[model samples]
Target: MSCQHEESMHLESISQSSTDHSLVVPQCPDDLFVVSQAVKRVKEFYAKHGEIKESHGWNHIQAVCDHTRKALLALDYTIQDNVVVEIQLAALLHDLDDKKYFPNTPPGEYPNASAILKEFGISPEGSRKNSYEKIILMISWVGCSENGNTVPKQVKDTDAYHLLIPRWADRLEAVGSRGVVRCYQYNQEKGLPISSPASPRPQNEEELWAKYATSDKLQEYMDRGGTSKDMISHYYDKLLHIARPPKDIVRNSYLEHQAESSSKDLVEVCLRYGKSGQVDKEYIMSLS
Candidate 1:
């Protein structure tokens, strides 16, 4: 969502419960305060056990927040009673109980994350609980079943897709700059190779195909040689699939950034490490 950034919200006071390790917002939160404090609490909350994965750690949350702001700014939205705030709030806590980071929490249960929300009086019967849980469930990976949202009760004209605004915002991070960072980080954490002569820079489209590309799905692509366990392979299989902006407005902005007479060089921009981070350029494709 190549949108202008949204204004920042502030959280004045937040503390963790020592007796129970649950977070407590210092104030009787207004919508802005609840959302802002939730965002502030994510890092500490997840880091409490010291097992947060670097790939999806607090920093990833910040990136998604930035992406969320951009998405909101790009939308031709008409708000109905702080729905935007609720979307962002749900986005803020999207990964609170992610299986990758909080394996013990498991699906079908809120566990510790629910306790944090409870301290600020966010629960099933709380004022914002229904909306909060709704948005969170919608954005979560497990929220969908059979390619449709688990909550399939469509609403008025635009609200039917209202939840998708935040959903798209959150996924933006999975494809672009943040995606590359995460790919490399995950490879490092899992001890996967970044690149080698065997998996050198892809010289053709077929070579760049994901290692998981089946012979049937992408026959020609599968014909190209590759090792399935490398970092580049992992990206080609998953992250690159999300490189293009999913929304029309955001896609328009993304196209504007594409190089003249080029296929956007999306991967190159990421592998370039646009923000001065690590990069691997073994692929021979020329990127402007």
Candidate 2:
């Protein structure tokens, strides 16, 4: 099937599914000349990067745009010309850095992808920068693989909630430390505030024990337990596992040691910041 056809099918399935929040198709305004131009630029940008055979290729951008639009619709967002344009821009540009700089590596070790977007005038400082910065920052937060970066409580909570509800929590968790840390850092950079008390400082082995001991946390959050701590814990554990490497690799040689080590380290950083009370719970939970 054609890529467009496949995209349409995916969108239709998303729209028809009762689990997804309802969405309204947006109408383009007659005077949206600038938006049209932005879309054109975005198309060109994707075309250029699409040649790479990796996750950040052209079709990936298209898929993200489709998913993003549906996500916005589910939230009852208006998807105005500018919002649509920004979403497209953010989706396309989000992984530019990863594609160009870290294609072979996990997304955690790479620097901010927004720097390039900003240089190209596609970011907050550009002409139509309304929510552009926030959007980019949100994408960055969700995309990052490191910790110590603080995210607004709301964004953190929203994202965490989405992770659990849609069963993407495991994937998000699987991103391990690097992903969670980056997400937290993005949230903090945006000045998003924390809604709850900071988690206590996790001691030496406490971090590891807390994770295995609280595996139930995952189930609790999935089952709609009151607080977001469980989700946070689950994410933390996943990140930790990714960042650290197992000692008995020879016995389990199939494991990607480097990737596993990176993942564990990434989660460790997230735990540090989270215990320091830097991450925003509400924001992570609010993701659609």
Candidate 3:
């Protein structure tokens, strides 16, 4: 199928899945207002750049919004009106820099995208002003590591977690699994080691074993007919790998034991706190 056709089909599938799962909430009055204003701002920004393709343009925003809404609902979290609006705005305009400023090249080679958002009047001073900045940061986070300081760990976790679900479900089926296997085969053919085991090492042996042990636990979850929630939980844990150190320090202090006694289970310990701790402690603290 053509790229346009594939994009349309993907959007249709997302819409149908979202509806079937009762994922799309009717917009509250406040949410509607924010969405409308954001939509107008996004439209105007894109218009100045010339004709924008829907698949590569607005529909991408729709997909992200749909996935994000479903994720929030699944977590039994209240979807605040402004939060949804901000997330939508971020999703919509995240790629604007790629489309306009970079065009043929990648956005990372240029200045930060948040600066461009500010230039486009998307970052007008108010509570909503920071929304644009947040979105720009998320875009950069996914695109490149350099200018991703503004991308909160929460936003990154939200985006990555949502993107992984459909794939997880799809890959659960035989055909999809075969497709993934085939892709791996192709990668191997192209000189990638698609299934190589890690070389044995003595350094950090305990930490390495702890990592494998957690992987075993996740595999056990999958073996026992794991639901999407289980998978999401696992993915969330994986994302929190960096947050474990401070938590370990604190937990060790609490136990009146040296940090050395704490099992060097980096992934599990890190995942226990997840992205929230990573953001507040690692990201924001670094900024200060």
Candidate 4:
């Protein structure tokens, strides 16, 4: 089936089912084939590398792929089928070489993702005219100290518009209540506290990375059982700022507005709990 969600759900519901079962690949044959292959590869990768944290685990990949598929459907007239394939593949494999997991891999190298895509006939070289690597480089919003948290220079013109779908879709997953839960989960895994009354909000992405990133820093947080980095601080530094002003790549006022509203809800909950260690009943009722 061309439906990413149906294929994903089947994969989940079955016991190691083959990608061919009930699959009806058609039209964009390479897209269907590559996506199916990508799904299988990601499942295997996460099964091995996913220590225990679900923060950037398989579920996150599924959500991002779903978001990308939906977002692209709205711009179907402008995007090509191959571009759709590239974007979805980027979303599915975005975290494979995450600095959090594969700390030794250099930024933008994407060894893990590169290998998987090569197997699927997608080479990882911008000079090769392969848009796969460009999409991969464009979708990452973290772990590149040189690039900060923005689109890279490699993505230009229409490719910029096409590549941005996965990036923003991934960002959408990191906003609102889901983002709060993920932050708490990651903190618990790293032995960081849910909240620290003493630490200040991070001044920039550099400070954020310096404090709570990399395998070495993860070990330090585990050993110390804490740091200035905490779940609340993470919200202030990153999660709270999920929505940004529209850029040239793409603009969806509805999505931006929804992200802002959801972020506000998360911020209110964070503020209430950070202050009193309990949710305000009045606010909870208002959400209902």
By lDDT, the best candidate is 4
- What residue runs in model 4 are displaced by over 4 Å at the alpha carbon? 1-27, 125-129, 141-159, 199-228, 244-250, 277-288
Model 1 C-alpha lDDT versus the unseen true structure? 0.48
Q: Write one digit per residue (lDDT tens) for candidate 1, span 88-190.
A: 6556667677655565765566555566677667676767677747654544532211112222345334345555544554445554555555656666776
True-vs-predicted CA distance for residue 272, candidate 3, Å: 39
Candidate 2 residue lDDT tens string, 134-225? 55554554432322123446545544222111111112233534245444543455344333343334544465457442444334443552
lDDT, each prediction:
0.48, 0.41, 0.38, 0.58
* Order of candidate numbers by TM-score, starting with the best: 4, 1, 2, 3
RMSD of each: 9.6, 16.3, 16.9, 8.9
Better of 2 and 4 by lDDT: 4
Query: Which pairs, if any, clash in model 3?
Result: none
Q: After superposition, how far is residue 156 of candidate 3 from its true place, in Å?
A: 10
Clashes of each: 2, 51, 0, 2
249-288: candidate 3 lDDT, tens digit per residue: 1222212121233233323323333422221123212321
User: Can you give the TM-score per candidate against the true fold?
Assistant: 0.63, 0.37, 0.36, 0.70
The alpha-carbon deviation from the true structure for residue 161 of candidate 4, after best TM-score superposition, in angstroms, is 2.4
Off by over 4 Å in 3: 1-27, 40-55, 99-124, 144-288
Off by over 4 Å in 1: 1-29, 141-159, 193-201, 205-228, 245-266, 269-288
Off by over 4 Å in 2: 1-27, 30-43, 46-51, 76-85, 99-127, 147-288
What TM-score does prediction 1 earn? Answer: 0.63
